[model samples]
Target: MSDQLLQLLFTGLTLGSIYSLIALALVTTFKVTGILNLAQGEFVAIGALLAISLYATGIPMFAAFILAIILVAIMGGCLERAAIHPARRASGLTLIIITLGLSISLRGLALLIWGTDTYSLPAFSQGGPLIIGGAVLNPQSFWILGLAVITLSVLYAFLGLTYAGKAVKAAVINRTAARLVGINPNTISFWAFVGSGALGAAAGIFIAPVTMSTYDMGFMLAIKGFVAAVIGGLNNIGGAVLGGLLLGVLESYSAGLISSGLKDGLAIIILLVVLMVKPHGILGLLGERKI
Candidate 1:
């Protein structure tokens, strides 16, 4: 591969890891509750902002990250109870609209609190870029990739081996059957929302050093995450991982080889093709188990 190509690959994979985290959170929320949460991205923005604020207040980075995640998770749980549970009987479209409303509300709230400022954090580690074949690789990229692998592995184990995880899967596949088997879908859904919040927040904080974090960042991030989930198969956990990586690579390559302005459009284009060609996602049609 050319030096430029190698560099793009590294950059793409790092970005893909962040997208994977967001995609996972979106998938988790959809599987547990049939809601397409447009507000999920807001959790990311909020979490990043909170962590940065906390860190600015002289708190350790580790403590700031943990506190932001926990607070966002709690907020997710509260929102599910306040807004989602009450509309359980609503149609899927209605539930989606509710999330959209929530998204707008959250964005407005964030604007009120944080204004239009953009914030970023220091890299988790202090080091210069690694050189290989005349391509540069940031040290923080390893942290991103390592976290992605660990998160995916932990989630895979949890869903496949643990009773609670099984219950979550059962709830995703068939809530009615899960209930008959003594599983509480409602409770599971609540916890899933909380988990999604933590996942989204972690993604936000991890990428903050690499990208600017603004109140409005959630809008585009949410769209990209949803597109990734759709392309990978919203019902398939593994597919989300694949989709995120694929999207990231495509974005990086397009930006490097073509025009940076057209890079974001790839998500919409790929999403359309995927929906038209294979609505079940890359793995969904293969009868992949929904994690």
Candidate 2:
């Protein structure tokens, strides 16, 4: 019984890390651009699929991963310049709707390119599961967790210790003031999408070994990530990561102890409860400053 619980915990953390990455990507974009990107998940699918294709061409694993992530980031910037930039004067609601449309279009493009097939990436390390007190842990799980930690750490440092990062925060906090201070809102917005795209793609590459990659997988992932973001407080970045891990653990326990069939529904239930109890999220308090 103890082993079973431990096993569930391990699984939950692994999956949660992926959710954290996705949620972090979403929240970061929203913070910098004030635009919630519903199409973020498509970057994940495209990254994994593109990585697979590149790796198949005999490129080394590291090179393939870099190439795919960079390509997606570039595409994100291009989309922002071509589609989103022109709509700069549109209302907030209109911008969100445009993102929704972008999501649909990306998914359709993915389907056309990858078809209905599913693909997988090789685990970062080849090894059998490790047994800890009779509970088994997969090697890929560590890679996922490590990736989450590294990504979070790097992002935190960049946002906290750099001039560009401060400029971004300033732009989001007050566009008029930021502009007066010589910052460019459009450039900030463009970079936000690019960073968001890179984060999404990196998540897909790491999780592909376990979840498998499919053309239609991004939409559901985006939904889950959004739920995580809301649970953590849309305005709080750290809250998003904690929220993803918390949600993942709860989902794991529900599946293991109650019924696997109820797993997907569990997220929505938690989201509702969170919204009702503390709408600002676990870390976000009323009148509190955002990070």
Candidate 3:
């Protein structure tokens, strides 16, 4: 259709890709530990802020990004070992409260250090937009999309092929049995936390240019991601990605057709509709409903 329509669609897809990455990271942690980790948004914020600060301190950009991911991963592992494992037997409500507490604590910590200022990094590429026929696309958008695809591909390979990945999957299926088979399910849980944190941080780093970074950004982003996960079917990682993309596109189109002010509320409306109709989500077909 028109260039404006194509531009809106592309923008929606790119933003949706960011949401998908965050959702998948949340799913990875949930599958292994059964904790939704509401602190995920904080993890993304922490990664972006830390990496940006590091780069500001004269560290190379690539090195700063790598270190940010690792640091976030470490934080994830530590949180699991210190906060999650201790209350492993607690009721689901208790566990959720604990994660919420962690989210609050992390946000406070970030604000303490970062001083509540908004920040964003320069795009990895400094060149002009790539124009195609009627529409212009940013190279940064491609970078974000490419990273999402690579992350999913690598995650699939880890969960489906490698021995460590298989062990993690087995742990998810049957923790006791996995332990009996010489797989340390607890260790796998820790790894899941690390992986999830790293992925979340990477999303934060890449998308910082598009969205202003604030201590509270994580909480907001996490809420949208939670809706996406619920709509996609929490247990299905693939569905998480699809649901995120769908939500993003819906929001984008709604903004184009309606009002920008209603875009955020529209996500909630879509979530309500999905829950009312299918509560379990698109991938709920797998088995054992937890959504």
Best by TM-score: 1
Local accuracy by lDDT, each model? 0.88, 0.87, 0.84
Q: Rank the candidates by TM-score, best first.
A: 1, 2, 3
Candidate 1, residues 112-225, lDDT tens digits: the string is 999999998999999899998899889888888887787777877887899998888888777788899999878998988888888889888888888999998888888789
User: lDDT of candidate 2?
Assistant: 0.87
Q: Against the hidden reference, what TM-scores do the models get?
A: 0.95, 0.94, 0.92
Each model's backbone clash number:
0, 0, 0
Model 3 RMSD, rounded to 1 decimal: 2.4
For model 1, how big is the CA root-mean-square deviation? 1.6
Can you tell me which runs of candidate 2 are displaced by over 4 Å? 172-177, 285-289
Could you arrange the candidates by lDDT from highest to lowest? 1, 2, 3
lDDT of 3: 0.84
In candidate 3, how many Å is residue 110 off? Answer: 0.6
